[model samples]
Target: MYKSNAFCRKILCGVAFAATVFSTPTFAANDYPNKPIRILVGASAGGGTDILARALAEKFSQALKQTVVVENRPGASQTIAADNTARANPDGYTLLAATNTNQAIAPHILKLSYDPLKDINAVGLIAKVPHVLVVGKNSPYKSVQDVVNAMKADPGKLTYGSSGIGSTQHIAGEAFNLATGAKATHVPYKGSSQAHADIISGEVSMMFDTTSSAMSQIRGGTLRPLAVLSPERSPELPDVPTLAESGIKGADMYTWYGLFVTGGTDPKIVELLNKTLNDALATPDIQQRLKSLGGEITPMSAADLAKLNKEEFERFGKLAKEANLQAQ
Candidate 1:
């Protein structure tokens, strides 16, 4: 009888331990973000991603009632920050301020220390900024066709600039040449600013850049906008036509910024984050602030963003192959 009683108590103790272990997740959920959160960036400070992160951090901190900090981890083609975010704990704190290059293209271009898609769980898209085909204000190429004519005439002699060898700007310029039958030699710089400088100084023929980066130059008449690499016209540069209207319907390319946590983050937590992000973007203030920066909010679920990231990465593969881009 004593043995039976002791066994019963043991079983109860086992049950109690199991319940506590299972309830741990609830404890996590209840006390999520107990401390300040870190939103890591894979770029230099004051860059587009950094700016957007600061803005989001301001509003997100209010929403979550916790201090959110922005940390920039530049260089190695953003591998440093990407790896950091991928390796962070899956609790609701650390996040990657992801972009197309880091999340989609980097895996294909060069080897990375961590698996971007598998190691990181997408939170949501932040903003989408289209690249504009900009030339020096005094250039003779008045339109996309004119630029194509010049490129076809000069072939590799007509050089264009890009942010880097494996950048979206590089891919877009290459793809544009492929689709439009323009054969310009690609001249890559360490960053868009360098390329834009050369273009403004007429050292390079042309370049495609994000509206935000090129906005000041465009408005200041230093860089003339020929076409925007989007399916539609940019509200910031409404006068410019989509690269499609210039006869290349698919020349449209964009720079997208997003949020992510380490993969295998609890599904409920991921969903909660997704909903919070979408709700944040839906806010009139956020939308207006983003739009003013020549971008639009692109709210999406974690799964949807992941699917979109994969599809876009794969699609860029086809475009990259078609463009005959040499692997770097």
Candidate 2:
């Protein structure tokens, strides 16, 4: 009788432990997002990144039944905001709205406090906006070939403006130089607005600005887009040609945005976040807004985003070396 009681007790304890272990994840997922969630943007308010974040926050709030907020931390090539997110508690309450500048380019050119791949896990990709080669309306250069010829004629005379050092714009400019074998000076500005200002005033020769950022100027006839630095032509500007078509190869670039949470976050939470994000992207309102911003939405799973993050990191490392980009 004593042996029988002991065996029964052991079986009950084992069953209880197994149940607890199996049910924990479900509880965590169901109880998740009971509090407000905040997404950190590495750019200032009203910028493309911030705008995207805000738009998603509204959708996230609606889907999750929780208040979602966007916080701007805009500096250090977006590393500041990235680091903050990396250091936040892995509770799914904090997220980073990251761009290629911080995820791929800045890390190659700056000494960061956090490891982009290890310290933060990518939740999913949001959208990508291609860069367009633009010059002031009054500029003499009218085409990609014209810019290439002028740069070849005066190796260091032609100048291209970028948002900042190690920015996608800067790397795009360098990539153009590498592909075309033409040298042009780089003028780094504090932000794209400043770069646009200089380009409009003819202080800078040209700029590889994102279509979203330069759309207003392009439509206002203050800026003339020469070609898109993308694999294909932009739907927003169907008339514009791609750099490849214009004889410039190996210079395709885009400013891609994605969501990331601190490393070691619960996989269930990450899965939920990815699902929520994809749902938001699928909405008609989101699709229309992103389309208006010259963005392309391609929903990707968490694993897919992780793979892309790794590939972009490796690709940028090689490109930076070939372009002789140095950490500042």
Candidate 3:
């Protein structure tokens, strides 16, 4: 009788332990974000991602009633920050500032240690910024067709600058070539700063640069906006025409930024975060801040963001194959 009692006690203890372990997440979610949160960006300080991250951190701090920090882990095309976030505990504290380049294109250009789609869960989408095809203020190419005609006139004679060899700017340049049936040489720089410098000096012909990075120059009348590489016109540059409006199809591209947490995060915690983020995005102050920086607010639910992430992953595969981009 004692032996049977001992066995029953052991079974009860095992069940209790399992229940405690399974219920811990629920408990954590109930008191979600009691501590400070950190949002990691995969770029150096002062870059577009970092800038946006700081803005978001401020809003998140205000909304969550806890301190929020923006941490930069720039390297390997944003895989470093992503890997760090992926390895972090699936709690509500650590977050990743994910961009389409890191979440979508990097997987094709670089062999990542983690599966971006599987290792990170989408919390919400923040904004989308289109790349503008800009030339020096004095350039003779007044329109996208002018550049296309010039490229067809002398294939590979026109040179374009980008942030790097495998950057989204490079991808945009190549997509432009494929779409226009024109060949243009690619001149890559370490970052957009140097590329923009050269383009302004007429050392390079053009660059498909983000509206945020090119906003100052555009406003100063230093860069001529020929067309934006998005399906829709950017409100920041409402006067500029889209590639489609310019009669150039199939070169559509835009940079999107979103929020992410480690995969397997508690659903309740995720829901709380999504609510906080969507609320922050809806604030008039946040809206104005993002708009001033050339970002178009594209607030989306977590489920919708996840759906878009999957679609972008597949679309990038096609772009990689079409552009002959190989994994380095």
Candidate 4:
């Protein structure tokens, strides 16, 4: 009887241990996101990146049934925010609204504290927006070809403004120069608003601005859409031709946004986040809202986004080397 009692106690203990071992992951998965989630953005309020972050945050909150907040760090060309997210706890509570400017371009041109490709795991691609080549309404140039011609006619005389030295706009301008042999002087601004102000005031010649950022000015008639820096024309500016259409091949530039967490995040958590984000993006409301902002909802799997992140990282590294781009 004593031996039987001892055996029964051991069996009970073993069963309990096995139950915990099997149930922990399931419990964690279901109980995740019990707290608020924060998404870090590296741009000031009212900027294109900030706008996208906020919009997504709201949808994420709705889908996850928890509060989603966007915290703006707004400096260091977005590396500040990227680094913060990279160092955050490897839980699903913290995320970063990763952009090509921070993930791809800044790594190439800036001295980063963390590796964009290795330090973070991409949850999924959120959206992509094409850059629009625009000039002041009263400017003499009418099209991308016109600007290129001016640059060729008097190299280094024409000037272009960008959000910063290593921004997507800067890359577009430099890529344009490489493709069309135009030498336009570059002027970096603290933000796109300042750049747009200079362009409107005629202090700068042109800018390769995001469609969403340039939308107000374009509608206000302060900026004229010359050609989109995309392979295809934007629906928002149907009249504007593509750079390729203007004979500038291989100059297509689009800023892509992704969701990310620290690299060591559990695969199950990453899968859940990807599913939630992709589902939110698929909703009609999210689709319409992003479309209105000149963004194409291109929801991709986490694996695909990881592949893209690495490719862009390598591609921009090569570009930076060829252009001799240095951290400022």
Candidate 5:
């Protein structure tokens, strides 16, 4: 009896030791982001992605007790920054301020230096911004149906510009084509700002762009809103009808913002990022700032993001093939 009790005590001690060994990393995350955290933005500054990246970085900095630096590596449908993050150290210092364009859409289209799903671990979703299909204020097409009619009438004459090829806006436009059975030739630009610029100057007829980038222009009479792609009209633009209301359905097509890091980063690190980001997202300043930009903050766990990413990739992949979109 004495020997059995001693063995039981030893076994309990060993189990406790094993538990501590496995659990220490999680308890250690409170000390994470001790160094300056690099938040990679896949687009140039001043665009929606950049704006949100900076906004969240500022909030994360204050909360995490570390400087959250926003780095721009814009190129190739914003895959440059995605690839950079994929290849970055797994130490939690480098993270991608990812968007649907770079995280979900571009991976399906752009031949990149890294793998979106395999090379990166999603931290969490930052926010969601609805898109507006807008045209020049002077354009004759006033509504979504009118644009579709014109496309059907001429097939490829009316052109729409995007931030770049394989971007969310680009794929959103193609998805619109898939829904409406009206194909529009896609013209790519360096960024949404330039795409909006071209639309303003009538260099491009229209674009499916983030509401934040096109809202002021639409309100100021520079661009005309054809439709809001949300299931309902946006609070900022309550007058615009949804694409579903205009005859397109089955695609929500909203622009999503997320944070990610190179895969193989400790799961503890990923959860730490999720906690920091979700906590920051719940704050009033970040919430209001993102809201004012027409973005809705959504804090999801890494596992949730992983599952959601697979769904989005499947969704866009199907649409891309259906639209015969050439992936590079």
Candidate 6:
């Protein structure tokens, strides 16, 4: 009778432990964000990604009634920040402000310490910004065809600038070469600002710059807009034609921004973050701010963001393979 009672006690203890273990996540999710939350950005503060991150952080803090912070890690094409986030505890506190460059493009070219799709759980998608093909204000190439004609005529004499090799801008330039059957020498810069300066001064022929990065110069009349590298024209630059409209096909591209937490995060926490993000995005002030920066607000569920990330990863992988792009 003593032995049987002891065995029964052991069984009961095991069940209680299991229940506690299983219920811990629910309890944590319910009391989530009790402490400060941090969003890691892969780019330096003041860049387009950082700007959006700060904006979203403000919204998240207000919605969750917690202190949310944007921390910039800024290297290896945003992978440093991503890897850090992936390795963080699966609580909802540490989040990654991810872009296509890190989530989709970098994995194809750079050796990464984390699996973007697997090591990180998608929280939600925030916005997308299309690349704008631009040239120096005083350039002779007036349009996409003019640039194509120049490239074909010189057979690699024309050169283009980008943030860096294996960057979205570089891939867009290479995609342009493949689609239009033109060749232009690629000149990679340390950052978009240097590339923009060079392009504006005619140091390079052109650049496929993100709309947010190029908008100020474009408005200042130092950089001339040629076409947008997206399926459709951007609302910010509605008068600008798409690459397809310019008779260039198979080269549509854009950079997207989203939120992510470490993999194995509880579904309840993910849902909470997703709802907060979508609600923040739906606000008028936030909408206007993001729009002014040339971003299209793209609120989506965590599952949908995951699906989109996978699709982008595969698509960019194919593009990288075809373009013979490798990190340099």
- Candidate 3 achieves a global lDDT of 0.85
> What is candidate 6's TM-score against the reference?
0.89
Please report the candidate that would top lDDT against the real structure. 2
Provide the lDDT at 7 for model 1. Answer: 100
Superposition error at 318 for model 4 (Å): 1.7
Candidate 3 runs further than 4 Å off: 136-142, 149-157, 163-167, 187-194, 201-204, 245-247
Ranking 1 against 5 by lDDT, winner: 5
Q: Which stretches of candidate 5 lie above 4 Å from their native place?
A: 1-31
lDDT of 5 at 159: 83
Say which prediction, candidate 5 or candidate 6, comes out ahead on lDDT: 6
Point out the worst 10-residue segment of candidate 6 by lDDT.
188-197
Q: What is the C-alpha lDDT of each candidate?
A: 0.80, 0.89, 0.85, 0.86, 0.82, 0.88
Q: Taking the tens digit of each residue's C-alpha lDDT, what string does model 4 give over 16-81? A: 999997777667767887899999877767677877788888888888889999998777677788
| Per-residue lDDT over 1-328 for candidate 3, one digit per residue giving the tens place of the 0 to 100 score | 9999999999999999999999999999998888999999876665567877898899889888999999888766677889999999999799999788778887888877899898999999999888899999988899999999999999988999876555677789889988888899988664566677788888899999878667778888888999999888887888999999999898887788899999999989889889988988899988887897678888798899999999998888787876788643
Q: What's the TM-score of every candidate structure?
A: 0.84, 0.86, 0.88, 0.87, 0.86, 0.89
Off by over 4 Å in 1: 1-25, 138-140, 189-191
RMSD of 4: 4.2
Q: What is the lDDT of residue 162 in candidate 3?
A: 70
lDDT of candidate 5 at residue 146, scale 0 to 100: 85
**Tens digit of per-residue lDDT, candidate 1, span 174-244:** 77877877688888665566677789888899998777667878888999999999888888788888888
lDDT of 4: 0.86
What local lDDT score does residue 77 receive in model 3, on the 0 to 100 scale? 64
